[model samples]
Target: MKRLLAILFFLAGGLAAELAHPVQCTLITASGPQQKRRKAQ
Candidate 1:
């Protein structure tokens, strides 16, 4: 029972990390072009 709980906790952490990564990447990507446009202006 303890082992199963541990495994579930680890999997939940991994899933949260996987979910957060793309949002960070998209935020960076979304901001990058705007910064460049500002510089150009």
Candidate 2:
């Protein structure tokens, strides 16, 4: 039972990580374009 629970927790953690990576990347890249515009000004 403990092993099963551990596996479930690990999977959930990975799923959460996978879900967050795209959002984090989007936020970083979104700011990059804005920064370039600011530099041009």
Candidate 3:
């Protein structure tokens, strides 16, 4: 019984950590002068 409880606790902690992190995304504009600089370099 004690071993089973310990296993459950370990699994729960792992799942909690996994759910804590969230995804992220960022966007950049591709307007005229910015596009020109990229091509020039």
Candidate 4:
């Protein structure tokens, strides 16, 4: 249970960090989604 809570806290921290800076996230998503969606076909 402690391990699970630690992982959750880690993910939450990373999410907060990302939300604090969105340009990199938008660029990654924009470049990744096209290739991923094409491959999913």
lDDT of 3 by residue, 1-41 (tens): 99999999999997776688533223555457544345555
Candidates 1 and 4, the one with greater TM-score: 4
Rank ordering of all candidates by TM-score, starting from the highest: 4, 2, 1, 3
Candidate 1 C-alpha error for residue 18, in Å: 0.3
Candidate 1 local lDDT, 1-41, one digit each (tens): 99999999999998899887744554444434343345555
Clashes of 2: 0
- What are the clashing pairs of model 3? none
Candidate 1 deviates by what RMSD?
7.7
The predicted structure with the larger TM-score, 2 or 3, is 2
Going through the candidates in order, what is the number of backbone clashes in each? 0, 0, 0, 0
- In TM-score terms, which candidate is top? 4
Stretches off by above 4 angstroms in model 2 are: 23-41
All candidates' lDDT scores?
0.74, 0.74, 0.71, 0.76
Instruction: Please estimate how well model 4 matches the true structure, expressed as its whole-model Cα lDDT.
Output: 0.76
Over the stretch 1-41, how does candidate 2's per-residue lDDT look in tens digits? 99999999999998899887744554444434343345565
Better of 3 and 4 by TM-score: 4
- List the pairs of residues colliding in candidate 4: none
* Candidate 3 positional error at 3, Å: 0.3
> Which lDDT tens digits does candidate 4 get at residues 1-41?
99999999999998998899854655444444444345554
Candidate 2 lDDT (Cα, 0 to 1) = 0.74
Question: Looking at candidate 4, what is the lDDT of residue 11?
Answer: 100
